[model samples]
Target: REDPSDAIVLKSGLHLDKPLDILFDTKAGTIGTSSLRRIAQLKQLNPEIKIQDVRGNLNTRLAKLDDKNGDYSALILASAGLKRSDFNGRISHQLRDNWYYAVGQGALAIETRVGDTFTLDLLKPLIDLKTTYECLAERTFMQQLEGGCSVPIGVHTSWNNDNQSLLTLEGIVLSLDGRTKVQNKMTIDLNERLVNANIDDSSCPFNYTDIAINQMSDHIVVNKLRNSAILGYELAQSLTELGAKRILDAIKRQ
Candidate 1:
């Protein structure tokens, strides 16, 4: 299961309805967008509210938030991380609306020596194939676009497991100031591709072989993966055509 992207953790007794100052870590692009988006939205409502950056691990950050004398009235954090640290109670609001998650956010990944069948076998049962497919599309989009921490790029993906599994991807490129953004969504019927590739629907969880180890080969399943990745590449191309590249390029010169 994918965890929610990011959330607002307020000081004890603080309310979301109340005006407040916010704190966030600015080093990581994923969390940086969270802060910038909130700042942009809040500026429209409470022009005087403050936002500042304070970097630390989950525990250290929690210590800062719990300090009564802390300057920040609230904290923006990954809901998944907060929960993992056993501080879910501090989360007052999950930020999703008008927010696109970082590519592959909240998804777990394990990397081992290539061709390590032992590790692969151990991890195979825990793998969520649907999430894998979704993340693959997002990562492919980022890789092809050459997205990096400096570029404010994000994506959200959903998989519908109906009679035909359909994958929907929404991607965005934003200006540093957060005042401008280009976003687009695309959907592809992945089940159709799998069917055409002769992959059985009964295979509830596709074997890892479906993923091309390095590049395309004789495996029919590899084509299915390639098609799914192509969907993302196509979406990125459409967004670039709609001026995403210009926006990204302008940001880079800064």
Candidate 2:
């Protein structure tokens, strides 16, 4: 399975050519954020090409692209959905890794109404700690940056399982015209994050039975979540200082 964030899917047997109109769904928040970046990258390669807003579900969008009635040379979609639908073979281009994906892309969310303790309890065990940490960082970044679903904000996060569990976050904000862009990256040590949470490293007993690390799982995970949020807020602040605030404000005005 490939990471589908901002990936391009073309008509079968067709390859990318010059001056193509890339189809994307403006209704989906990710399109506005990532498509703009893709458009910028494409312009760098071929200035004549353009991006078109197309609205529909996966099947409907695919139908339009297959029929070629929308004048779209290719369609860009999240690889996660394509792969989940067993359509990985249809991907023509994976896009470049340099492109940041929509915050929490490819991850699932569990939402429970207020006072719904039953539902919350049911979902607790299903939570993926690493994914939770990453999503928290991303969401915090967006929150601190005052970005919304419609804003052109993007992020990518990774959990390193090396010497100490390390969480790295990379984020960006791009102008609507795909011209101006601001990006930043940050990393934090998950263990130290726990220590900062008042969990004494020397006193804490960690069971190394599982390589994935389940020692004091709940405590470590909770602290990791907190640390991730702080990291995201800090990174967003860094980007703001780099002039992302201006770029974001300009996009909002448009």
Candidate 3:
């Protein structure tokens, strides 16, 4: 999050209390408008705040926050980054439920040249099954909307860990301005066949990949995340139809 100790007024006739975090790197893509709303709320609370622009890669951005000179107070990077760089210790906070993260932000992806079964097999165990499936739903939702990095979007997935295991997905889209947002949620029961695949010895066998997904679905905390994504998507769609485009157009113009 940016901390402009200075204050600036917005076109909306609102004043910011502190600097707001608005920039999404090319790597993180365009974040959904729902995230922007949170920043707006902060502004509403503190009308004297200032907003500024900052640009850099993940490591460079973090360095700005940790700079001994105190040029910055905090930095917000994707949770996935810490895992990728093995820098989990650097995460000052984990905004898991309240802040909707980018699709596949904390997950790992494996890409290989075509026909590389050897490498695929080597990396197969490293894959997280739940993360894969959840990401699948998220990516699918985003792709269906014909959106790219610039689109404001968020998604989350979870599994029902009751005696009957089921998969649930939620997605959100938002306009560039903080004014409008949309969200959606869906569920699927994977208990019968999906669970069996993990338990059966004859099958490929379930690994941490599978376990992580199942655990995520079954976990109580993830339930809120699932719902948040759903609400966010519905809100985004509605906002888009109701003049979100105008706000975005203005943002682009500026």
Candidate 4:
């Protein structure tokens, strides 16, 4: 289904007043945030439910659910990964817009150690500004929450370049049972900075294209993005602290 339509369907299925949880793969990245929030809410009401973890590769993970002896009540995987692995049939649950995909889960990254002038120069031109900013915000959010790929969280970001660089990020946290949820959004200005000296389009050691290279350095913009993501994370934390923990405790008792 189209993203908007899919979002509608997923949103309609959520029970924000109840506690629910989700399990996702590490490769699926940051989509688990929303899942955790939703599930937490459900736990607040029942306080006797259970949310746990299960792991495996794509097909193997799905197979566990079908096995009669398997303990999982549901499975969560990236829409992209499912499509890539040709396992769309396994996605019994698709989250709503508030609980959308993370920044770069389906994308690839090329990182070089700091001070590696050669690799830095080689990889600079290959960077996509939009992708870079979105991923930066999402990763920052994950880091601030001290959450890993296994958490029930999700983040989706957008950029507006009309005047200043403005980024909008939507985030979600869910409980394990997929019953409770919480979501929030934040925006930031992308300040410009000088480009890294090591990054150039010259046909030197690493030949690359200079596509959408902003005159402003991505460093400052990335920092702002990180802060924005943290803002969303803090909001989620508040919700978790106030009500989500209760739900989790109740679920554990069950």
Best by lDDT: 2
lDDT of 3 by residue, 159-187 (tens): 67663346666555555443455555666
The better candidate by lDDT, 1 or 4, is: 1
Q: Which is superior by TM-score, 2 or 4?
A: 2
Number of the candidate with higher lDDT, 2 or 3: 2
**lDDT, model 1:** 0.63
Per-candidate TM-scores read 0.76, 0.78, 0.54, 0.51
Best by TM-score: 2
Name the lDDT of candidate 4: 0.48
Model 1 per-residue lDDT tens digits across residues 19-125: 22243322211211234434444443334445666677877776776677776666677788878778888777787766676777776777677556677777766
Q: Where does model 2 exceed 4 Å of error?
A: 1-4, 16-47, 161-164, 194-217
Error of 4 at 165 (Å): 4.7
- What clash pairs does model 2 have? 4-79
Ordered by TM-score, highest first, the candidates read 2, 1, 3, 4
Alpha carbon lDDT of residue 203, candidate 3?
16
Which regions of candidate 1 are displaced past 4 Å? 17-49, 115-118, 161-164, 194-224
The superposed Cα distance between candidate 1 and the true structure at residue 200, in angstroms, equals 20
